[model samples]
Target: MANHVYTAAALAAAFFLAPANAQASPQAALPSAEVTTAVDDVVARYELPGIAVGVVVDGKVRHWEVRGETAAGSGERVGRDTLFKVASNTKAMTAALLARQVDAGLLAWDDPVVKHLPGFRMYEDWVTREMQVRDLLIHNSGMGPGAGDLMLWPEPNHFTRDDVIAGLEYLKPRWSFRSRYAYDNTLYIVAGEVAAAVGGAPYDVLLRREVFEPLGMDGCRIGEWRISEAGSVASPHVKRQGQWIARQDGEVVADMPMAAAGGVRCSLDSMLRWTQTWLAEEGDTPHSGWLSKKQREAVWTPHMPMPLTSRMREWNKSHFYAYGYGWRLSDVDGTAKVAHTGTLSGMYSAVTLLPELGTGFVILINGEAGEARTVLEQVLTKHFTAPGQNRTVAYYAEDLARERAAPESSAARQSSGAPVADARASAPRSIASSSELAPWLGEYRDPWFGDVSICPSDSGARFESANSPRLSGPVFNAAGRFLVDFEALESDADAWLDFANDSPDGKKQLTMAKVDPDADFSYDYEDLHFRRTGECASQ
Candidate 1:
């Protein structure tokens, strides 16, 4: 949210004395002029709040830089080391820690998860019998989208190694053992627990000892946010009511024990250094190296093929989009691109690397007011696309709209047309009164979700998960089931809705779909629909 003690004058003095280290990647021989064009095009196209980006090629970081305002409405410019919540990118860091520990003989890559904490078990009886440390790093743990998030959000609750193990019993394994790939943060949290247990220390503390401290990443701290001189460290901003406002993340989020998964924050430069270490040949750094050739090879291994690899390739048209340890593997510019993207409330960031080419870049952005995917895709398209090429990037419009509307969930929860039976969902375009929402408020249960309740209260429409934090939404649509858009989540995580309608002919029917299929993650958006089996009588 703010800068370090090295003031502006100090930066200027250092620039003069230290011959600005800002150089283009050393090995690629990429035209500096072309790099500038890519960055400008991305910044202008997405209207970013502010961004800090760095590129390292040929063993030197020549393009770590910043652009835009700290907050959209404020004149303050983003700096080199502003703390950013690198969302799921935290997975890579946590994975790296595991890799390092494995390399140092502190742990074994194939060790059973229960070996570290005897409390470990699995939801699928088969998984418990066959699970390994590598499986945890892979997204094959079978935990659902947010299996354990309930324990970490709204209010920080206590869960032990046993709690994580017990979650295994409650899990509904989507894939047959390791047959598919699905991203789950719950496994990474378990990884952190294993790291701590194996190292006989806190995971964050072990991470600093193994990775951060030796890498000269003195400024970056895991879990603990080292406030830059001021607490108002360039917070991510979101557009609320057409105005840019600084967004504050949840107060309870910091106290989480699983810093390895999504709790870490660090500056852009620190991030660059971290990735640079991975790109080093066998982790033999220009200074003291921490990783090795075997370790690096292990980290980059695509241990398992992703589920529906064809579909993800169709969407990206770049990489195969599989999990390689802590990174997402894809091909970019004729090189295998290993990358990770992060999101936590208003902050978003991504780091992409082409290790074979020794060229990698990290883009860190502040403010959830915009989409990190677009912001990052813009950054990549600018750099990887041919110079003066007329490659028109085809981005889905509905995705962009959801990114712009996320902070203000009120506007998106509205219906666009008259209710239709079994038609696509229409989110409430505005808040719905209890009377308008009452007919739809009730308990919904699926074999997968168990039981979730929609209740109308004096305040508004509230969604209560079986034991998860309450997510509130304003009525944005009413086409089928009523949909409410949650104000704070990345990856467009929205709820589906179901409603009962009695037509002019006195015919009764129940229907449900995503609040808006147009924005649903379903491969075919409009075809996305969910039917209701019961009515308000079930509430």
Candidate 2:
């Protein structure tokens, strides 16, 4: 297939010269056959259950290519109107809502968080007092990445917004306030509460009235709403034993405690409109009115420096990367790119914007297909950033093959004597006898997260959480190390249970960490510090 790369200068000139109303007109050309072919190849290669791709050029949705079933065999085809959870992409919209509040003179970015939520508090007293509203959006809170996320996920949990807010004071910081960059979702939840406190309405209500309604993003849904009323919604899927299985049935009737951080369902049409709002220039009627010129700039401006990963360096030759309010700001191949990716269980979404060329694209997938998203993002981005280069699915497939075949790094080899596959195959799968599990049997408690009970089960030992019910599972022994194989398959976050060597005062304490290092950071099992409080309750 021929590469349909457009030069940045040429694309920018064409976009600027086009009539203002051209954005809504159907004059823009559709995506090239190459783009469609690439999307098909990725879907086939990754076996993604459903995907919705939308491209916006010259501030208009120029093309859309939706394919596959809402669930693997449900036969409900994904359409432009089919809602998929955009996850953390909702953060940008949350930031926009705060910006609207700022525009209305209701809140300032630098205002202390306590000014809005009087009871707001962080781990450190001084840090809590000094923390500003903008600090909540940017991920420089000194907390480790995805800290305290266990309270928010494995959904249908009992944790509430107040529980999340109150838990903040107990989560110990990894570093001093504003000392370095570390991504966090809990703070964004706090930001949402701040918006609600100032806006005199719930976060979802404020989002609907201030952003969604004004921007015509009618298909987006948040907070508590029945699945039946959701119209066409995509089910989240995960691959197990080489088969794609639906996890959640797209029912979100219960309130999402982390809704501000990552719980918004949107259709391709609505996402395109949201993208267009950001692509619009200052004084561009509805879009510009969404936020003042200053706030618009504020949301996109880089606030904290992000470490350049090997992927970013090699893929886009990106020099620097940082987090803005709700977006990531970076220069990709000499063109400024503002973007954010949302990942939740089996749902994934990415929104990329090239402001200089007035172009952006949204990729929403209702499956565990992060690799597919990466391949598509690079292929789409390279169309403008390095148009001359043809990086297709085949290219990425070969690249990934090479990466997989390469030997593990020295550091990796040293960390684990044997490969993960080898270790899993050789290790014992279950506890030997009930007597062996006695030392670890107890009701343990963490400060932020509530209670976890380890008790003898019919099979062996069982692990259960009080606040997070989905964490219940059988305990497995891997090379003398204890691990919890969560019964909730959708979570895919099995964690190792490590006990402290010395029990001061005869009290046992344990720490948990993910068995798979690459599991979602939100698993955050390593952040948990559980102390054996007492014997497990009757059951």
The ten-residue window of minimal lDDT in model 2 covers 1-10
Instruction: In model 1, state the lDDT of residue 201.
Output: 89
lDDT of 2 by residue, 216-333 (tens): 9999998889989878899998888899898756444676899999989999999999988888887654566767777877787677767667878888887667778899877788
TM-score of each: 0.72, 0.91
What TM-score does model 1 achieve against the real structure?
A: 0.72
Best by lDDT: 2
Q: Which residues of candidate 1, in runs, are more than 4 Å off?
A: 1-27, 143-165, 225-232, 249-253, 283-288, 307-321, 369-424, 427-456, 459-470, 473-514, 517-539
Q: How many pairs of residues in model 2 come into backbone collision?
A: 0
Reference-based lDDT, each prediction? 0.59, 0.83
Clashes of each: 35, 0
TM-score of 2: 0.91
Best by TM-score: 2
